[model samples]
Target: MRIVVCVKQVPGTHDAKIDPETKRIIREGIKVVINPFDTYAIEAAVQIKEEIGGEVIVLSMGPSRAITVLREGITVGADRGILLSDRAFGGSDTWATSYALSRAIETIGDVDLVICGKQAIDGDTAQVGPGIAAHLSWPQATYVMDIADINSGSLTARRMHEDGWDLCAVKLPAVITVVKDINQPRVPTLKGRLAAEKQEIPIWKAADIGADPERLGLNGSPTRVVKTNPPQGRMKKSVVLDGPVEQSVRRLVQELRQRSLV
Candidate 1:
């Protein structure tokens, strides 16, 4: 089994500034960290590798600084890391980002499984993983909570739904987006950290992965953010009442009736 986990480097703070001109988050000078949800995805992939006796490869696409996230993954047991970095990849939306990642996966040759987090915290758009599956024309399961079983060519997983979870079986070479309920991420050991420091992470560009220029970067994105602003704050006030239990109940009911809340 050769499992690939897709990780992302996201702004560590909620107060990250957005570029008004481009309508994208300004990444430079912002504190960066691995997307919190992606840690579960990495945990799931590492667990699968341990059970099946295979290698786990971590893949990330971002600016040159994003290499830190890849190295962090290596420290946590990923056998290898691949960084897709280039100026041309700037301002890519989910669609173009997935297209580029799909191309890179193809370049990596054979892969048994792909896993990713349900969403990135910065964007809060859970689209990239499914987008990658669409580009690869493979089966995908989103919001996965558990891997029930896996063999040589097939896997059974528990997918989270609104009501509960559904068990689904998929062939090898499938993609899955995992939620934080999957598993707890392991801490990097001393040996793993040393190994990661010495590892040479291969970098790829749009051309290296054979991605079409017309289908990559901002130009290829079908959606665009025209503008963004902080949400308005609520200004409503609440009233406090003190009286006997029955009087208090009556007052509450009167307030509800006054506000048409019941």
Candidate 2:
């Protein structure tokens, strides 16, 4: 099986700033790391490869500096890494990004499965994975908590939801976005790190992937970020109840009633 795991380089800090002019994250000079959720996706792919014997290829789309995340994946068991980087790929929204990635997958060919994180922390739209599926006309299962079974033909996975999870089966050549509940990521070995450091990751440009120029970047993106604002700070208040247990319980009930809380 040829499994492709989609990874991303994200700002390591929670205090990432947004570019007021572009309405995008200001990534310059920020310490970067692999997307936290994507780590679970990588772990899932590596586990599947270990069980069934296959190649695990880590793919990412970002600037040349983003190669760090690709090499990071290799240190954990990905067989190889591919990067999509070019000026034309700049300013791509989820739709354009997924389209480019889908094109790259087509270029890779013979891919049996594509695995991705439920969402990127920086963007958090959670649309790219499903968008890739839509572009490829393949089945997709998102918010996957576990993979029960997988082979060349199909896979059975548990999908997570608000209430709980449900099992779903999808044919091969499908896409799935995994949640952190799927697995704990393994630490990289010294030897693996050395290998990753020496590995040669090929960079693919937009033309290399045959992505339509009309749908390549900012101009190609249909959606626009009109505005951005920092999240409102929440207020916190606490009261202490000291008395007999019954008395405290009654007091708590009265307090809740006063606040219109059941």
Candidate 3:
């Protein structure tokens, strides 16, 4: 049960600006924290490892500064960390991003399962995990609410949907993206923090992972943004109900019926 968990560092504030030219979030020099959702994936991986007895390795892709989140992962429970960083990976979209990640996993070689958050808060596309599965030609279960069981060769989890959840099972070397509902993340203990301080994380370059140059960064991405803008704000209205008790209730009912809110 060698579980690999993918985590990310996201802008800590809502004031994060976007690059107009590339249509991507501007991340340099910003205060960042681990993506909230990825914490659940980390917790899930740790729990699975605790149950089955194996190592939980955390991985991330970003600039050198993104190592903060990987260190955080180690402080919680992961055994080690790996970073995919290089100027060559700049401006990559979900497709290109997943390509590099899958290649890095391939370089690592004997991974049994890959886990990730349902989505990154900054991007919110929820595409990278599935894209990595596709690039690796592995089975994937997205929006997972819980891992029912996992052993040497196969795993089972509850997949979230609009109406309900489904019990999904897949073979080893599969990818799964988990939602925050899966579990509460454990705080980093004194020993864990101390261990994190001594760990030497390995950083991988594009060539180190055998990633094709033609499939990285902006040039490798097929999707293009014609324009980027914030969504228009919605106006709010207030109403007051003042009358005899019966009259007020009747008026409210009528208003609700008229607005089709009932």
For each candidate, how many residue pairs have backbone atoms clashing (under 3 Å)? 0, 0, 0
User: Given candidate 2, what's the lDDT at residue 173?
Assistant: 91
Question: Would you give me the overall lDDT of model 1?
Answer: 0.91
lDDT for 28 in candidate 2 is 75
Please provide, for model 2 over 131-203, each residue's C-alpha lDDT reduced to its tens digit, 9 standing for 90 to 100.
9999999999999999999988999999999999899999989999999999999999999999999999999
Candidate 2 regions exceeding 4 Å error are: 236-255
lDDT agreement with native, every candidate: 0.91, 0.94, 0.92
TM-score of each: 0.92, 0.92, 0.91
Q: Name the TM-score of candidate 3.
A: 0.91
Give the per-residue lDDT digits (tens) of candidate 1, residues 1-262.
8989999999986759999899899998888999998889888988888887898999999988888998889899899999999878888999999999999999997988899999999999999999999999989999999999988788899999999999999987899999988899998899989999999999998899999988888888898899999888776676677888899999999999998998
lDDT, candidate 3, 1-262, per-residue tens:
7889999899986657888987778898778999999999999999998888999999999999888899999999999999999989988989999999999989888999999999998889999999999999999999999899888999999999999999989998899999989999998899999999899999999999999999999889888777789888775666688889999899999989998999
Give candidate 2's error at residue 238 in angstroms.
6.8
Q: Pick the candidate with the highest lDDT.
A: 2
Error of 2 at 4 (Å): 0.7
